[model samples]
Target: MSRLRVGLLANPTAAQGTAHRIGRQVDHLLRLAGISVVDLSGPSAAVARARAEDIRDSLTALVVVGGDGTVSLGAEIVAGSPVRLGVVPVGSGNDFARSLGLAVNDPESSTRALLHALSRPVVSVDAIEITAAGHSGPGHRSLALGNLNLGFDALVNARANRARSGHTVRYTTAVLRELRAFTPLPFWMEIDGGDRIELDATVLTLCNTGMFGRGMRMVPDARIDDGVLELATVSGIGRRQLLRLFPRVFAGTHTSLSAVDIRPVEQLTIGLRHGRMLRAYADGEPRELLPLTARVLPGAVRLLAEPSGSMTADPKDSQ
Candidate 1:
């Protein structure tokens, strides 16, 4: 077997108090496993990405030691490259890590599992390619290995980003605050080259993985390697109904409601009819404003993971 050398990238802002501590543990573990660990972490995303690019050639795999945003940053660099990606879930909303069957709640176990996975073959997974409607610059395009969210949830994320406390508590507080002032806005969606369908919606999500917002099963049927994207929309519901349905997302039972629609597509174009410059979030990081096109890039990246049960399994169900 070839010698293992990994580039360790971490986002210190991910889980706050525990990220750095867990990162140290991961670094030590990888070294103990006889793998060369290169520190690619930086004070910011831009600096981290620069560091990753600088050492991409020497790495057998790039191990991400933060949350979904940290994974997204690593994905941007290693997506089409030969380097495979591994994740240790150290973020508050470790949705992508959960999709890969990594232990989300326990960093020590997750790091151990990741090390085991590194000793095996890699698996290819899908990623979403997002581009701004009128921007053709290099930075205008990006990749997401998880979900892209807009509308109500994005508003909550914006608020949560500004807060300085616990992730779950901050997110919950943001939800309540936004729910008190937010309203459904009109949006036009075009799917797989289909005609435009306009509607008023409170939540719009394009998913490659099944979960977002820590553990919300927004698209329960989504699979990262399925070579397709899942589109989910919630409309025709008042704030009261939406609040009631919100918790159901954790169980993925909200899709059974009449006001929600879920479908699979290969590409999507979304624009806001109200001319609101709503922000879009992918992998828990902010992206450009509205009028975006997202498409599935099948088997775009190789992920280091052990074989596990299907992603369609219920979250409440035992693994």
Candidate 2:
């Protein structure tokens, strides 16, 4: 067997320090599986990411022990490299971990699932490469492994992230807070090198792994390895109607609604028409403001996940 060194990177305070609590268990499990552990836990995300990249040449795998934001760190470091990305799922929304059929909020079981994934074939997944034209210098380019949120949903994700509460509760609270002042924004978008069209979008997200806000299937048919990304938009609806549609998102039945537009895009450029301020967030982390371009990179991530039965399991996954 080849020697394995798995860098265990985690957020100590995610889910109220549950990530650190679970980190110990995950570290123990990896050691038992004959893998050497490199603890990469840091007080902040920027420190953790910097450390992971500094030693990326030595690690065989970088396993993130938190939610999607933590996964974002791992994906940024190991994407297209020999290192594989693993998820342990202890954050507010374990969306990526749930995508792999792992049990959320259960550390030991999820760790065991990680071990199982290590022994399996590498699962190559697509990722989004987002460029923020508004920013200059080295930080302008980034990777979004799950989904990118724009318009109203981006506001909700940013709001929910600030609260110190459970996943569903914070998301619900954020939705209510944002709804009180919600209005459609004028967004201009171009797909596949085509002409730009103006859109009055309330919620716009470009999906790779899809689900966000814990279990909301913002794009039901999106597959991470399908060589494409999903541009899901919600528009032309009142606050009451949007609220009614929110519940359906969890079940992925909102695609049936006329207000929802789902487009399979390989490349797209987006910006505000009137130059208003609108931020785009990827993997639930703030990426950049408007004037953004994104494209799908098929097989960009070598994910440590099971090979089958872990994606789009809902019967209503289709529109």
Candidate 3:
């Protein structure tokens, strides 16, 4: 058998450590596995900065070590290519890893689990392609692998950006602060030529995977290989309703709320009716904004996941 060559796309800020420390841990683990590991350095600007084509050309598998943003970047870069992608959840919200049954928080265990996954069966997962105009007054496209969120979640992400720490405590502290001042934005959505829904929504989420921030099940029925996307929308509601529905998301049981509208479609476009510069977030990172097209990329990525991580048996999957 050919030896496994792995490429690591690491983010020290997201890893909650200095670059040197994170690099040493990664290098030591990969060496222990007898696998060749290459470190992609520099700022965490975009996957393009890593010279993705070269990594794909040389590595047998590429592993992303950071939060959902880095994972999303890796997904956009390696999907549609033949390379297999692995994830080591080191960031604050390891949402995708939860869906894969990968344990969170322990680096040593995560590394071993990922190495074991590399030797197991592989599965193809879906990704979402988001097309938006560049802020530089030019037209361009952006891609996201996880959920695309608006309103409250976007606000939470923005607030977290200003935080001094990158841990879960920082995220929760920001969420509490944002909740006190958060308000929904007026927006409209069109799904697969369906009727338009106008709403002043607290949050709008498009889910390709079932997990959301820190394991919230905003889209309880979302599936990674179902060839469709689940749009979970929460209308403007008071603090009481919001409080009641928010905590239940961690258990994938948020569909109980009356204000939620779940729509499954192959494509959708979202726009702000007033042309205001509203914030949008993809995979917990900010996006340009409204008037964008989201297309489904079915089975576009080959993922190395724990043998027990398959969502095929979950009855809640949105197929």
Residue 88, model 3: lDDT of 75
Candidate 2 regions exceeding 4 Å error are 134-138, 310-319
Q: What lDDT tens digits, residue by residue, belong to model 1 across residues 152-248?
A: 9888998998888788898888989999978898889888989998888999889889688888999887788778988888988888998898799
Per-residue alpha-carbon lDDT of model 3 for 124-203, expressed as tens digits? 78888887632321136566767888667777877877787755777777778877866677888778877887888887
**lDDT tens digits, residues 72-167, model 2?**
878888988878888888887778776656788887887777777776767778888888764544477788788889889999988988887777
Candidate 3 displacement at residue 100 in angstroms: 1.4
How much is 289 displaced in model 1, in angstroms?
0.4
lDDT of each: 0.82, 0.82, 0.73
How do the predictions measure up, each by TM-score? 0.92, 0.92, 0.86
Clashing pairs in 1: none
Prediction 3 TM-score vs. true: 0.86
Stretches of candidate 1 exceeding 4 Å from the true structure: 310-319
Candidate 2: residue 23 lDDT (0-100): 90
Write out the backbone clash pairs for model 3.
221-318
Candidate 3 lowest-lDDT run of ten: 310-319
